[model samples]
Target: MSRQSIVTAGVLDAALVLLFAAIGRLSHGETLAGLGVTAWPFLGGLIIGWLLLRAWRHPLSVVWTGLGIWIATVAGGLLLRLAGGQGVQLSFAIVTTIVLGIFLLGWRAIAALVRRTSRKRMPAPV
Candidate 1:
């Protein structure tokens, strides 16, 4: 992938993680002022995921990159939160896994679908 595409994927992943934090905070009546506190663990996990997977090489691969990112973001985030004295309730972990799976992998799946459709529509070389 191009450098821009790699950067875009990283940024998008980070933004989605931040959005998840914001949504959770808002739902629980928490102030946005503490959003960084909520988001940092997951964001750190996201970075770890990307680096471990060398995701930039196949940034849009749902199975290869996205799956790893989802797993790492959840697992790593939980560990970090636990270490930081944050709540790690079973229910919260379940919700986090489900939500982050969708948030992190959903976009790549959609992108793959769109790319497949576009390729089908493109004229083949004679």
Candidate 2:
């Protein structure tokens, strides 16, 4: 992939992580301060998103990408729980993964739609 595409993917991943954190905090009736300290969750989301993008043949395949990300995030969380001394909050991790997947995949879907529309609008060579 081109450097620009890589940068865009990173931006999308970061946005998804932020969105997941925001939603999690709101749902739990917690403050942003609490989220700030728990950076692992968001980092996990970022890693999952990046992996999904890397695994997919095309960035436009949002559904598959999202599914991949969801699977990876949950599995990663579980592994982390098993490997780490502390217990992992399964529910919280699952919810965060789902939210992050949706945001990242949703952006990809929108980008695909925009590209398709633009292609259709372009003038053909005479």
Error of 2 at 53 (Å): 6.6
**If scored against the real structure, what TM-score would every candidate get?**
0.98, 0.68
lDDT of each: 0.95, 0.62
Clashing pairs in 1: none
TM-score, candidate 1, is 0.98
lDDT of 2 by residue, 1-126 (tens): 557775766666666666666666677788877664344544564486557568434444566765666566556644654565535576766665566566767787788899899999999999
Q: What is candidate 2's CA lDDT for residue 68? A: 66
Q: List the residue pairs that clash in candidate 2.
A: none
Q: Over the full model, what C-alpha lDDT does candidate 2 score relative to the true structure?
A: 0.62
lDDT (C-alpha) at residue 54 in model 2:
80
Clashes of 2: 0
